[model samples]
Target: MQVITSESVFSGHPDKVCDQISDTILDAILEQDKKARVAVETAIKDDFVFIFGEVTTTAKVDYKEVAINKLKEIGYDEPFNVLEKISKQSPDIALGVDSTESHEQGAGDQGIMFGYACNETKELMPLPIMLANQISKEMDNARKEKYSHIFGPDGKCQVSVEYEKGKPKKVKTIVVSAQTKSWINRELYEDIIINEVLTKVLDDKAIREAEILINPTGEFVIGGPYADSGLTGRKIIVDTYGGYAKHGGGAFSGKDVSKVDRSGAYYARYVAKAVVRANLADRCEVQLGYVIGISNPVSIHINTFNTGVISDEAIQGLVSKIFDFRPSMIRKELLLDEVKYQDLAKYGHCGREDLNVAWESVDLKAKQLRKLYEETKRASQVL
Candidate 1:
């Protein structure tokens, strides 16, 4: 059996702690100042949290208070001393990015960002990542609601799924390393985690026969920032397709949508999902390239992995016509400014049904593109 693995972390995980804090600050700033330019980063170790980056906003945001509150909300009640080192965005960089009467807004920075979609899951995401993320969410929910006495805030999950002919056939293994109360008996702890967390999400045969490892390293009393140091943008693979696709190395949280890293990536996923939803392909990945201070993408490309009903070239042509890739247009089309980065900070960003993100709802584009694909197919069988 061929196996592919993907992992996810609980909200209290060190890196996620930083991710949430950064986005929480970003959210607060955006709420007060829609036009603000924010690119923040967070790092944590022990009882210390460091927030540093470039932020130009009139939102009157209390960055320190916001970061501390977010930490507490993630189930960390420890006293954390925070150090803030923030500065304004450089006017030199901002000069080319801002919109003018004659010049449209350009990209925030130069980089490659990828978006992916497949029919393996209802969310059009890879099964391994979707399941891994669900287990983590369930773990956090259990700690918050039922087993507060037994579980701690920090934890992680990795799921390896067996595939047959490129399709997921079953789950092969589940590895859970979670923070737990030291007093809980080993027997009861495993039972609770097995029944309450694992079975609740993966009761099917996929999980029943699989090997499940719980608290592999024994005691988990020491967890969260106390256990390890965490920095933002470190989990880029977990944030997106879970190693099923390539990443352009851009982190989404903490930055406002003005940065093409966040906005452009969202738009790329929107296009990939649209292609799959249109039945033009069973799998899709769209890559968008931008140069800082340029409003439009320097390159737009697509790969259907030989799963497209039409040729990749035809699909790329359709994408050019149906979607707008300009920095300003991407923000406007996806309603980026209106979204709360904190909500997307935890779960995987691309394929989310829980959040009402514009990128996920590509039905309008799907319908139009499906019709266009039919005409294009008739016009050129060569495609």
Candidate 2:
């Protein structure tokens, strides 16, 4: 059987903590200024949190307050303790993002972004990633619920699934590492994780046979930002499709939708989801490219992996005809400029059909794509 493995981290993980912080700031700015130019980066080391990067807008919001408040909301009860540890944004980077013209919008910075979809799951997300995220989220919930003797904020989860003939067949291995207060012994820690976290996460009987690794490295007393330096964009793979597809290398956590890296990726996913929902393809991957200062996309590519009844080229043509890939157009299409990304900062970004995110809405586009596919099939049959 073919095998595919994927991993996910909890929100309290150092890298994810940074991501949440950055996006929280972005959302705050966007709330006041719909056209806010935000490119924020956060770094967490030890007990200290350092926020850097730039944002330009008319909104009169306090960055420091926002940062501290957001941290506190994310289960950090000791703000005074952590606040003294954090720093402010740098003035140099702020100069570039505080621009006026549409074309003048430089990418908050240069990087690549990727969007992907497949028939492996109803959300078109890979099963391994979906499973990994489930486990990670469950761990967080268990901690929040005060599950006895579990762990602290820092945790990571990985799932490797055995695939048969390119499809997931059964679970292979499950690994979870969670940091606990110094008092908890390893024996009790393992018992708590297995019974409370893993059991609840993989409730399906099919997953019971999988191998389990609880803190494979042994001691996790030194976790969180203290043990490891955490920075924004470090978890890009986990944020997106868990390496099931290619990543453009652009991180999504800190930038506003104007940056194609964020908005464009969301639009690409929307297009792919629509294609699959229309039954034109069982799986789809859409790629979008843009030039800084240009409103329209520089390139758009589609891959359906022979799942489409129409040629890839034909699918591309239809996509170009139906979807708008321009930065401005994408913003309008997805209403992304209005989305509150801070909440999405935690949890997996994709597969959040519950969030009512514009990218998640395929109802309108799905109908249109199905009509296009039916017309194409009719024409081909006539020939």
Candidate 3:
């Protein structure tokens, strides 16, 4: 039996906590100064929290208050030390992004971004990642509600799915780990996780005969930053396709849309989803490369993974026709100024049906691709 695995962390997870803190600060800046340029990173170890990065904005951001509030929001109210080390954007870098010879908006930095989609799920996301994210979400919700007294905030879940001939058949195994209150018994902790969390996302058919493991280490009373250090961008895999797709190694949180690492990747997803939505391919991965101070991407790649209805080359042309890879154009298409990056920090930056994000909209572009594809097929048949 062929099997694939994916894993996700809850909001209270140390790395995710840092991600949220970074994005929350970005959100705060954008709310006041939409044109702000930000590239912030957060790190947590024990009781020390450090917020460091560059900022070019006039927004009044109380770094300490924002960090403390974010920790409290995540249910970590213990006393902690907060540090801030931020500066204005480098003049040399700003010259290119702010005023280029081409007069087009340049990328925030030089990097590569990747986006992918598949027909495995309605949202066009891989099966294992979707299931893993759902399981993690369930845990986060339960911990914030009546179960708060029974379970701590930090938690994660991993899902393994068995596939028959490349199509998922059933879940094979599920592993979950979460911090529990010291007073909670082991049996009760496991019971709460299974019943209140896992079962909520999995049906009897999925869980039946499946190997379920919970807190294998036993008595996970010590977790969060106190147990392990965390830094922003550390959960890049969990924040996107759960390692189901290739990542450009650029993170989404703690930066403005001007950063190609965030916007370029988001735009790539937008185009890839359009291709799958239009039935041009069963699965598609889009890769984009950008150079700092350049509006247009240096390279654009489309891979259909042997599942394209038309040739990959033909699909590539169609994508170019329907979408623009210029940094300024992408920002306009995805309405980057209006998005709440903090909301995207949880669950993932992609495959989000819960949030009405701009990149997730593909109906119009899908229609355009479908129309053009039918014409292209007819012409080829005649040839």
Candidate 4:
């Protein structure tokens, strides 16, 4: 059997903590100035959290308060220091993107963005990552509610699924490493993690005979930033498809909607999901590339992985007709500036159905493209 592994961590994880902090600041800025240009980076080690990045906004904010509040919400109560080095964006880089008399707003930066979808799960997400995310969410809930004093804030979940002929057939194993303030017996901890966390999230049939490993390294009493360092944009894989799909090597956190790394990726997902929802393909992956000072994408590619009813080129042609990859157009269509990104900091961003995110909307543009193709084929056959 071919085994694929995917992992996810709670919001309290070191990298996730940094992600939340950065996005918290971003959301606060966006709440006041929707057109703010923000690209914040955060790093936490021990009791000190360092914040540094570029910002050009009309919004006034207390950066320290935002960071501390995020920490407290994540269940970290220890005294901490916060340092700030935020400043306005560079005019050289902004010149091309700023509105001008000759050109529309150009891309914020040059980079590629990727989007993916598959029939493996209801959310069109890969199964292993979905299972990993579900387990992580459940673990976070336990820490927040009934077991606040018992379970620690930082934790990780990894799931291995066996695939047969490109389909997930069974769960091979599950690994959970949760932090706590006290030591609990192995048997008891494993039981709680299994019954309370894993079993509740994983598919019953897939995990029927799966092996579970909990805190395999004996104890995890020390975790969070106290145990390790965390930096923003460090969990890109977990933020997207958990390694199941190709990435354009861009991170989503700590940036405003103007950055194509964040907004373009969202638009790609919007287009790919429309393709899958239209039944043109059982799976789809869309890639987009852009250059600063340009309004349109420099490159566009689509791969259905041989699962499309038509050729990849055909799908690409249809996608180009249905979706606009220009930077300004993406921001406008996806309503990126209006979104609050803090909630997207924890869970994987692509397949989120819990939030009314615009990118998750299932549009029928691809379906219309398919209908047009069918009609053309019928007309040609009549000739």
Model 3: C-alpha RMSD to truth?
1.3
lDDT of 2 by residue, 1-383 (tens): 77788889987888898899889878887888887677788888766778877666787766677767876665555543333232333554445533565334433334445567788887778899988988888788888787535577888989999988778888899888888787887887777777877777666575568888988887787777778888999887887888888888888888887677888788888998888877788778888777665556667788888888788899888877789766666777888866788767766778778688888788789899888878887998999
User: How well does candidate 3 score on lDDT at residue 354?
Assistant: 86
- Quote the RMSD, in angstroms, for model 2: 3.4
Clashing pairs in 4: none
Compared with the true structure, what per-residue lDDT tens digits does model 1 show for residues 1-383? 58999999999999999999999999999899999999999999999999999999898988889988898888888788999999999998889998999888888899989999999988899998999999999999998999889889999999999999889988989999889888889888788888878888887576688999988877778898888999999888889989988899999989998898888899999999999999999999999999999888889999999999878998999999999999888888898878888999896897887898999999999999998987776777776
Per-residue error (Å), model 3, residue 121? 0.8
Candidate numbers sorted by lDDT from highest down: 1, 3, 4, 2
Error of model 4, residue 360, in angstroms: 1.3
Residue 268 displacement in candidate 1 (angstroms): 0.8
| Candidate 3 lDDT by residue in tens digits, 115-200 | 99999998999989898888888888888877899888898889998999778898899999888989988888788877777778
How high is the CA lDDT of each candidate model?
0.90, 0.77, 0.90, 0.88
Per-residue accuracy of model 4 over 1-383 as CA lDDT, tens digit each: 69999999998999999999999999999999888899999999999999999999999999999999999999999899999999899999888887778878888999999999888887788999989998999999877887776788999989998999999988899999999768566677677777777768865665668987888898999999889999999999999999988899889898997789999999888888888877888989999999997889989999999999889898787777777888888888887877789999997898898888889876566567677668756876999
TM-score, ranked from best to worst: 1, 3, 4, 2
What would the TM-score be for candidate 4 when compared with the true structure?
0.97
| Candidate 3 backbone overlaps, count | 0
* Better by TM-score, candidate 4 or 2: 4
